[model samples]
Target: MNPSQNEVLTPSQLIFIVNGLLIGVGILILPNSLVKITQQDACISTAIGAVYPLYICLIITYISKKHPNHNILFLSKKYLGNFMGSIMNLLFLIPFIFIIFTVTPSITNILRIYSAEFLSPFKLIIIITGVCLYTAYNGINLIGEICKIIFYVSLPLIILPLFAVQKSSILNLLPVFGSGFNNILKGSIETLYSYTGLELVLLIYPYVNDKKKIKNSLLKGIFLTTLIYVWCVFITVYYFGLDLTSKSLWPVLSASEIIDIPIINSFRYLFMLSWTLILLRCITIYCFIAVYILKDFMKKTDTKKIYFFIYPILVFLSTFFTNEITRRNFLVKVTPIMVIFLVIYVSFIALLVRIKG
Candidate 1:
């Protein structure tokens, strides 16, 4: 269904959207990257990385309160002027596009590895992108509702790790700071890339129905995301220790493999199936934002037509990184750059708003 252009999200919907965007494929593999950097202190890095989102949320709240009707697109043009602001707005659009490119391949590869080996990468990409396109076509309000449902449905899956905790040793988490302060800080920077979605708040701010509650809703969302990331890293480290967690590509999935459920023979498959919905939501949200930004630039274009134009390109580009190593390497190089750029971009915009006021 085509939502009205004036569609507005409630604070709870805002909370769920933030959580939905933050949780994605990052949770599945973050422990591996963190453990590689900080060893057993990976959870600490995960917790520290949360400060990035917290900072972004503060900036969003400040800017949104100051200019409730203006999204980053218009605000940039207003403060930075037509030429520079348009450049900045175009630059702002890149990360969302990168997310779609990187995550589309990553999620498809993940499903292939865990469950859908029979399916070709292109087929998987098409299926996933098709669902996302449909959702994006319906607009942000539907995406918000979907996020709320997926949040409630998939949250209980976090507890699945506890079933495997019996095999974990608290000793695995000992010598926590043994990774050293510098390494832990570096790990925090690396994990900070996983929090990419928080920047979308700037774009979505104008759509929030209860502007007064955006601050609290954003904080609630970021806190929930941080809690889950820390738990995933902590559990992975606790269960597999530094050596195994660092070596494993998808450490969380590896951790899930060990859970013994009487009803289900392989909890890993169940876990993968459940998270597939979460991953879909993550991609859909990014796709929607990308389309939304593009529509902002081309006001006369229908959003659904934009989706049709974009999906084929997403499908084709996604094929380039179907290999696991290629996909991981691309994201590793690209995501950090995107994160750093976003941080600087938003901070500069916030400063501009404050000064011009």
Candidate 2:
């Protein structure tokens, strides 16, 4: 199975895929997390936080440009030697699996909280996991296509907060440098959880049709994601004020309650429904990466058998966290670990690749 025989991703599809990866269930809670630390300046914190992932994307793009048509797994093997590369690959795969556990449960928890409180987590996991497995087993091209569709479908919902802006108190953001830059910087840490999934580009760059466009696609995707994130934070802050936004579990969803559409009696439900798509898109990417890594490890071209075996374990693990607080704690505690691993792995590889050349 030559990589080229699989479908090639257009630059736009690449952008959507990265964007989908960046903006997941994180949006629902980001406002509260930032507000609690930064107060009225959460939007500022969001803008500052945006820089980190872009810098990461730039580094990834640099590496990918140096090794076009090769993914991180391949480069690690080539540059790090078989023994060391296999170790690095395992390091990468562990977090990829952890992502499935952390993100899948969080999304299911959100759906249960907002849409179906009566529904059990086990049932939700089964349904969501089934969909993710089906999508991932198809291959990168299908994931790219689904990501494009999810991106467009989610755009209007992402902007739905604009309708409530009139009700929002711009004055709520007074004393713009609230509690100084220190708190803003602290709040930026919260934003990292939101930006976690963009690292998918390390695997994605190889499958892109026009390698030259990778940089542009990555930049555009990050920019778009930052814009949406900032918008969400701004709307949540403006609509709820600092005190309410800080206290609220999910300021974005709570703020959506203000949107009253004649066609739909439940705008909040509609917003949550949109989130189902957004979250599913994110989960699918993580599951796909897991399958992708397993296939690479086994030297198997077809992932159907591998996916079947892995998907059930993913589903079972996803049900471990029974509540939102537990799910959030898992994300907060583990995100830094994954980020640290990614930084160390990429920096080490970059240094080695440079030294070797």
Candidate 3:
């Protein structure tokens, strides 16, 4: 494939993909975790913590806007030389895979726990790998269209709490800062992982047709996601309080479990349904980035053959670690370094783009 064959995604499609990328994986777990730290005032801590990532998005957008028709990978190669740029891309690629390995299984475990305990893990693994591979096999355009579909379906899942609000107490959010700034900041760092996927926009900026609008769209998408996250945090904290939410492994789902109604009487089922939608979207987008990063390294765009390579590698890597406890351990232990790496990675890209563009 050549430069002329490249297709830039429209700002709206990029926004759709960005929305999907921002909202998945951690949203279900992190809100509950924050309750442990934030206690009664978790909502304030969460909303305040959102600022740091939104700032990072803006900085990356600044860098992205400087390169009209290129992405971080291209800019890095231009300024840092082939070897170093490839290393940076690989750095991102590793974390991207780690994300896939960690998130898909967590989602699967949740599904098994609530939706279907009889579903075989191996069968579920194939289903996830197949969906990721299918998304990877298609080009970026199809990826965006899939995201568009995902965003609509997920809207309900993310917002389902609004329906069953009779028992919620805004007072559950009282006793502000009992945890202090340090613990709250700690929650922010932990929650930061949930919001980091918005920066995947940096990876896909090249596919956006108008570079100028990319920054605004990126921030807009992040803003909406962060807002939803804040609302969810409020709901969980208000409903469950800190002690209960902290003890629960899947806090978001736990909170959802309590929601009852004449309409459905089961929030867990709705939570699982929504979780799957975002999970599919998030995996597809990340795998696409991982495959393309490899393709850029190899100087090819024939995504079909590349998906063949990725699917097996991921399946094999995924098998080494089984059980939710092991997966959660890896995700928690490695995620901070992942965020640190991301901060540096964005700084590196911003600097390179400034130097070269």
Candidate 4:
């Protein structure tokens, strides 16, 4: 079914929604992760990684233009047939489900370590998931609104890292490309997981008010995301140097800790508070997309009822990885696989659309 008037989003809202998704938990630790592989050239790796999303945006734009009325769910079923299409749709849901599983735990762990050590994981999970459920249940229009607000509110936090520039050493990044072509490529691959949320555009394309602007919106969103990521990695490496950044679990957080405002004693705390909202937006978008896709399969059920079932399962699954190491390891291993599946899935779908047309 097509989106109602209430569900339609403007081009700017679409940009913010995509940005909100792309800039979540990944930003917290990306500097550390990239530094481990690309050393001082982590920023370059980040720029390289953005190409994946750029490519996806182009492919999705083509597919959406060809089939203006249908999202990926209906498109899959239309071209691939009931059995194979249903299977593909089910596989499509895996990444969103995986995101919910991995991101919920990761966000809780970050909050506990950085802001709310006093609270238990279950309590934090309840708070986070509660907000996510409420937002997701409201539908994509509300989620888009929330994302736009969060995007503007969190925009200032982007410059918080710039406060560290005065103390940063330019020498840390001097030997650029020292990581070699192979290592840079590997680091770029590592960043593919961070760029996962861009695919949500495929699902939401039908909801955009100006379908013709979707391609520009996607490019702008990816461009904004790449700039933020590159800035984070560049600033972290400049501030901490290669050795220290490689050791930091959340280097961006660590970098923020150094920002000394006149009134605020701990900028890190302020950063975490603001960042928690952005993270919530990310989870909420994922939850909404998952529920939206599921609605296609469960045509008779209400969305709220689906969320009731989904949230409980999410809370239960999030409890599996009790510590940071396990959660990080699980994401590290699984994300690459998810990335591969998404690449193949989008490419195959796009190819089918081309040939059939």
Best by TM-score: 4
Candidate 2 or 3, higher TM-score? 2
RMSD of each: 2.0, 1.7, 2.3, 1.2
- Model 1 C-alpha lDDT per residue in residues 308-356, reported as the tens digit of each score: 9898999998899888788888887888788879989999999999999
Tell me which residue pairs clash in candidate 4: none
Every candidate's lDDT: 0.87, 0.82, 0.76, 0.87
* Worst-scoring 10-residue span by lDDT in model 4: 159-168
Name the candidate, 1 or 3, with the larger lDDT value: 1
Pitting candidate 3 against candidate 4, the one with the higher TM-score is: 4
What are the TM-scores, per candidate, against the unseen true structure? 0.96, 0.95, 0.92, 0.97
Higher-lDDT candidate among 1 and 2?
A: 1
Identify the superior model by TM-score, candidate 2 or candidate 4: 4
Q: Best to worst by TM-score, what's the order?
A: 4, 1, 2, 3
Candidate 4 lDDT by residue in tens digits, 1-357: 578999988999999988988988888789888988999889999999999999999898999999987888877888899989999998999988888877888889888888788999988887788789888888888888998898888888877767657876799998989989999999998898888878878888889988889999989999999998898888889989999998988888888877877766877777887888888999999998888888888989988888887888888888887587888898988898898899899889899899997
Q: Which residue runs does candidate 3 get wrong by more than 4 Å?
A: 1-6, 265-267
Residue 122, candidate 4: C-alpha displacement in angstroms: 1.2
Candidate 3 local lDDT, residue 166 = 75
